[model samples]
Target: MSAQEEIDLEFLEVEDLLLRTVPGLAEQWRGATPDEVEQLERIAGRPLPRFYRWFLSRMGQSMGPLAYPSQDFSARRVLDCYARKIVAPNPRFLLIGYESDEMMPLHAFYDLDAPARGDATVTARYARGGDDPIDRFETFHEMLSWSSLFRFQFEQMSQKCEGTLYREDADLLSLLAPVLSSLGFTQPLTTGRYCGLYERADAVMICGGTPRENLENVRTFLLGGSNAGVLRRILGEVAKESSLEVEVNTWTPALR
Candidate 1:
C-alpha cells in the first residue's frame, strides 16, 4: 500500500476500535460537563476525534485520580519518578523521535531520586538491536501521563498494531479521570505545567495528516536547519502575547 493509504487505513481502524470500545462517546461529548470537556480540549488543543473522546469519557479503565494499573515501582526508578512527578504541575513526560523509516519502541522516564542535581533528568531506553540507540535527550517540560500515554498509544496503534489482537492502545484517560477532576488540590500557575517534546521521521509523516500535526510541525520548524532563527521568532511571539512576561534564567545564580 502507498504510504498515504497506509496512514488512512490506520487512522480509520483506530477510529473503529475507539467507537467499539467506548460507546456513546459522540452523544455524551455533546453534553459532557464543561470542566471535563475543557480539560480534554486543552490537552488536545482542539475538538477531539469522536472515538478518542469516547474512550476518555466512557470505555476502558475506570476513572479516578492518578491511580491506574499500578505496578510495583520498587525496582523501577523511571516509573517511580513518573508517579512521583505525576502530581501537580503535571510532571515531565518524554517522547522519542527518529527517522520516518525507523521503527523502534522507545521508553522514557524521569529519575528524580538519582544523583543528578539538575532538578530532574530524563533517561531514554530503546532496543539497541539496530544501528543507533533511539534518539535521546533530557529536558524539563511539564506534562501529564494521560496525554503522554495517549500519544504513545496513538502512534503505536497507528503503526504497530497491524497484527496484534487487542491493539496496544487502551483507554488510559479513564484511569486518571478522577485525579483530573479534583484539580483544586493542586496549584495551577507553576512552570511544571508543560509537556516534553518528541520527534521522529515517522512522526513527521504522521503529523502531516492529522489535527495535531502542528504540535510536531513546530518542533520540526524549530529543530531543522535554521533553529536559532525559529527560536527567536517563537520567543518574540510569546513575549508579545503571553501574560506571564517570561524572562530567561540561567544556572549562574548557584555559581556565584
Candidate 2:
C-alpha cells in the first residue's frame, strides 16, 4: 500500500455519486479482497500505489461507466490492456478506466513510478491522439470522483417533468421502488444531496425534491434513456401501482 491517510478513503463515497449517473447499470460493487490485491500486484510485478490499491478494493469491480465494452475492468484488465497494446506497457502505469468520447475514448492510468506513490498522478491519452496527454489529475481520487462524474454516457432521450410526480412523495416511492428493483435498478446513482438518482441499463431516474415528506417541495423528477418506451414503462407502472397522474410535454408540445 502507498501513503494514503484516513481522508483518502472518502473516494469510495465519490464512486457512488459517479456511478449514479450511469444509465441503468446492473453491476454490483465490493472492493477486491486482500488476496485479490496481492494477485494484482503479483501480475504487475510490484505493489500498486496505495490510492490505486484502495480504489481497486473499493470500486475495482465497477469503476463507473466506461466506453461501451471495448476495455473490460476485470481482475486482469490492466494487464489485458497492456498486452493488447491499448495503453502504455510501462509496468508502473496502471490503467484505471477509460472515458467515453464521441471523437475518441481516453484511457486513464496511474503512474506507479511517480515519486508520490501514495497518491500518484493520473494521466489520460486519447484513443488516437498517440502519446499526448489529453487530461491529467493530481490524484486518483480526483480522477475517479470529479473527472469521471462529469463524463456522462450517451442517452438518446431525456425529459424533465413540467412539475413534480403530482402525488405524495411516499406514494411515489412505494409505487416505483419495487418496479425499479425488478428491472435490476441497483447501485444508487448518487445520495449526498437532492432527491437521488438511481439507474439500471435501460433507464435513469432523478428525483429533484425529497419525496414522501413533502411532494410540493419536490421541484423536479427527471427520467431519461435511449427510448421513449422506457419512460412510458415507468409511467405505466406508476399508473398501475398507484393512481399517480404525471405528464410532460417532453419538449414536444413546447415545439408545437
Candidate 3:
C-alpha cells in the first residue's frame, strides 16, 4: 500500500479509539481544507512527506485532545525556528517537532529517504546541529498513536476512574472485562458515562469500545485515590496471566 494509504488506516484506528474513549471530545476534530494544505506546502518550500501530507489534509487543524501535539504541523513554525537560528534543519531531514531538555531542545525529524517505503522512522536531532543518536519511533503513525495515548492519559486525570489499564494494538477490555466480571466487578451504577466502563468497590476502569474491540491504552495510573496500592498487586496477577506490559505511572502533579 501507499504511504498515504497506510496513514489513512492509522488515522482511522486512532480516531475510532479516541471516539470510544472520549466521544464528546471527537466533536472537536477539524481537518484542513485543500486550500489550507496548499498554503502550508508553499511555506514548506517543497512537498511534504506522504504521511505528513495526508495528516495535514485530513485532521491537521485539530484532533480533539491532540489538537496541539508534540509533532509540529505548521510549516510556519519550522520556518520561524530556522529564521531565528534556533536550530539548523538538515536538508535530508523534515523538522516535525521539538522538545525542550535541560541543556537544549531536541528536534524530531523524518528521514527524506524512507517515507515512500511505507515505513519511515522519526529521529531526534540536536538543537544546534548533529544527530541525537536516538530513533523516536519506527514510523510517524506510531509516534502519533503514542502521542494520542499520552494526551488521553492527561485528559483522564479529570475523570472518575481510579486507575486504568491499557494495552496497545490489542483488545484490552475484552481480555480484562471477563476477568473483572468473574471477580465480581460488574458495571458501575453511573449514568452518562462510557458504556463499557467498569468498577468494583475501590477502583473504576474507563475503558470504552463496549462490544467492539478497545485498542487504546491508559490503565495503571498512580495519580490518586487509595486504590493505587491495592490495585498494584492485583495488576501483577493480571499481568502474569494476561502478559500485558503493565506499567506504573509516577504521581502526576495536580493540573493547574
Candidate 4:
C-alpha cells in the first residue's frame, strides 16, 4: 500500500480517552489477536501501518498527541459479527462503530472507486442524514488526500474529552468546519431536517453531531469544495468580526 493508505497508527494513542468517551468499551477491548491483526492486514491488502498495528497491540493504552478512542475492537468485533457483509474499506482496513440508544447506522468503508486510481469519494447515510465528500480532482491521490484528512479528523476527535461529540471548542470548530464544509453533503437539497459533516471512512453525512450531546451542524452548504483556495475563503470569513448567525434556519433530524 502507498504511504497514504496506511491508517495513522498514531491514532491509537488516545485509547484511554476513547475508553473514557465510551465507557462501556472498557471490558471488551482485549488486544487484537495475532490472527485478527493478520486478518486486518490481509483485508487491507497492505501491510498494516505501524501506527494502527501499535493501536491494535496496545488497544487499551493511551499514547500520542491526538489520543484516539479506545477500542476493545467492539466496532471491529461488531463488524466481524457481520463478516460476510462488513468488508474492509481497504485490504488493511479497520472498522469503527457508532452506537446509541437509537439505532446508529452501519459504518461504510469504501468511498470512491478503486483506491489505486486515486479518484475516490466516500458517503454514509443514516435515517437522519449523511456526508459525501465532494469529488473535485478525479485522481486517486487527491481522493486519498481528502480521505486522509478526514480520517485524521475523526480519529483526532475520538480522543477528545469523553462524552463530547465532535470538538466542542469553538476555535477547533472554526478551524475544521469550513474545510469540512467543502466536502459536500450527499443530498444538496436538505428538506431542512438534517445535519452533515465528514467521516473517517471518507464519506459525508448529516450525522455530524451526537444527539443532544454536541448537535450543532456545521453548514457545509456555505463552503464550496476541498481546494485550498476555497478553504482560504471560508477560513477568512470565519475570522471576520461578524458572527455568521443567519435568520430562522430550519431542518429536521432524520428519523430513526
Candidate 5:
C-alpha cells in the first residue's frame, strides 16, 4: 500500500479501538464523497496532501470536539476567509479548522517546489496577526493523530473531574483567568459559591485563594484521582503556554 493508504488504514484501526474501548466517545459523522474531495482540490487550485484528502473522505464533517471543519464550509470558503482577511488573513496558508474565540486555527502550507512525497507543514495559528510560530507537525497525519489523542485525553479528564472543583485564592484566580483563556481555556464562570471555574473541553481549573491553597487543591485532586496523568499533561501544557516557571514537584507526587 502507498504511505497515504497505510496511514488511512491506521487511522481507521485507531478509530475502531476508541469506539470499542471508550463508551459514548465515538459518534457517527457523515463523510464527504469522492466528487466533493475533487471539488475541494479544484477550489484550492492545488492538490491537497493525500492524508488530508483521505481524512475528508473518511470523516466528512466531524462533529463535537474533533476540531476538523465540516463540509458545509468548503475549501473555497476557507481560502476566501484567509484571502479576504476574515480569519488568518494570510494567503499563503490554507485554513483548516478555526476556533475564533481561541484565536487559533489549523493551517497547512505545502512546499509545492519540494518533492511530492506529500510533504507539508501543518501548524496552529494562535494569534490574530498570523506571525508567530505555534505547534507544528511535518505531516497531516501527524497533526490529525495528535489532535485525536488530545481529544481522547480531554474526554477522560471530563469523566474524572465531573462536578469536582479545584479551589484557589480569588485574587490568584483572577490573575490566571486571562492567561488561561488566551491558552484556549473557556471563559470563567461564577459557581455562585465565591469561586469560578475555567474550562476547556474536559479540562478544568478552579481558582479561589492563595497559591499555596490552590497548589494543595491541585495536589489533592491529582493524588486522589486516577486521572492524574491527564491533569498533569494539561498543567504542563498550561505552564508552557503561559510561560510560567512552575516547579514540577510542586504539583503532583509523580514529579516529586
Candidate 6:
C-alpha cells in the first residue's frame, strides 16, 4: 500500500480503538487541512516524516489527557520552544509531541543527507535533568502505537468493575494496569475510598494508595511470605505475556 494509505488505515484503527475505549477523550480529536500541514513544513524548513505528515492531515491535533500539544500550539511554536530550551545541541531534531504532563518533548531527527525513508529516530527528552532522551523509538509509528496501547489500557483500569481491587492514585494505576493485566488479573475494581482488588489464581490481591505505597505492599506480599512462591510463578507468567521487561525492584515513573 502507499504510505498515505497505510497511515490512514493505521490512524483509523487507532481512532476506532480510542473511540471505543475512551469516547469522551476521542471527541477532542481534530484533523488539520492540507494547507495547514504545508504551512507547518514551510515554517519548520524540513519535510516531516510521511506518517507524521499523514497524521497531521488526518488526525490533526489531539486534546485528550494523553495527547501532545493541541493545534493551538503550532508545530513551529513547539519547535521554537525546543530550540530555546534544549541543553544538548541536536540541530536535526524536530519536536513532534510531548508527554501527557508536558514536562518532556518527543522529538524526531531528520537526516537530509541520507537516503529518504519513512522512519525516523524518535526520542523523549526530560526538562530538568540532562537533555538526553530517556526513551527512544526506531520509528514514529512505533511511538504512536505504544501511546495508543497505553491510553487504552489506562482507560480499562479506570473503569468500575465488580470485586474491584486496587484503588490508588490514577497515575499509579496507569503504570500498573498493563503489568497486572499481563499477570492474568482482572481489571481493578474499586472496593473503598482508596483501595481496589485484582483476582487471579483464585485469590484477591489488595492494592491502593500512591505508586510507591502500592509497590511496597506488593513487595511485602511476594517476599518472605507463604504465598510468595505462587505469586512468583504468576509473575513469571506475566513476563512471558508482556514485551515490557517487568522489574518489580524498581518503579518506573510515567507521565499522566
* Least accurate 10 contiguous residues by lDDT in model 3: 188-197
**Best by the lDDT measure:** 2
TM-score against truth, every candidate = 0.21, 0.41, 0.51, 0.33, 0.45, 0.46
- Top model number, TM-score: 3
For model 5 the local lDDT of residue 181 reads: 75
Tell me model 1's lDDT, rounded to 2 decimals.
Answer: 0.28
Clashing pairs in 6: 164-189, 164-197, 165-189, 165-196, 165-197, 166-196, 166-197, 167-195, 167-196
Q: Rank all candidate structures by their TM-score, best first, as comma-separated numbers.
A: 3, 6, 5, 2, 4, 1
- The Cα local distance difference test for each model comes to 0.28, 0.53, 0.52, 0.35, 0.45, 0.44
Find the 10 residues in a row with the least total lDDT in model 6.
Answer: 217-226
Q: Distance (Å) between predicted and true CA of 203, model 2? A: 24
Model 5 agreement with the true structure over 176-245: per-residue lDDT tens digits: 4566677566632222222334556546554321111224333211111245676656556645654443
TM-score of 6: 0.46
1-256 in candidate 6: lDDT tens per residue? 8866776665564445445544466566566666667755664467767757755754555435546443223344444545576523244555555344443243444322221235465554543335644334445444454444444442233221111122223333344446666666763222222233344533334333322122322211111112435545654554464332334441122112
For candidate 3, give the lDDT.
0.52
Candidate 2, 97-159: lDDT as tens digits: 655454657676655665242566666665334674533544555444433333463233453
Clashes of 2: 11
Q: Which residue window of length 10 is worst by lDDT in model 5? A: 216-225
Residue-by-residue lDDT tens digits, candidate 3, 121-153: 676777665653455554665455444444554
19-84 per-residue lDDT for model 4 (tens digits): 433434555445556676776656566654344454455451322222224322332563463475
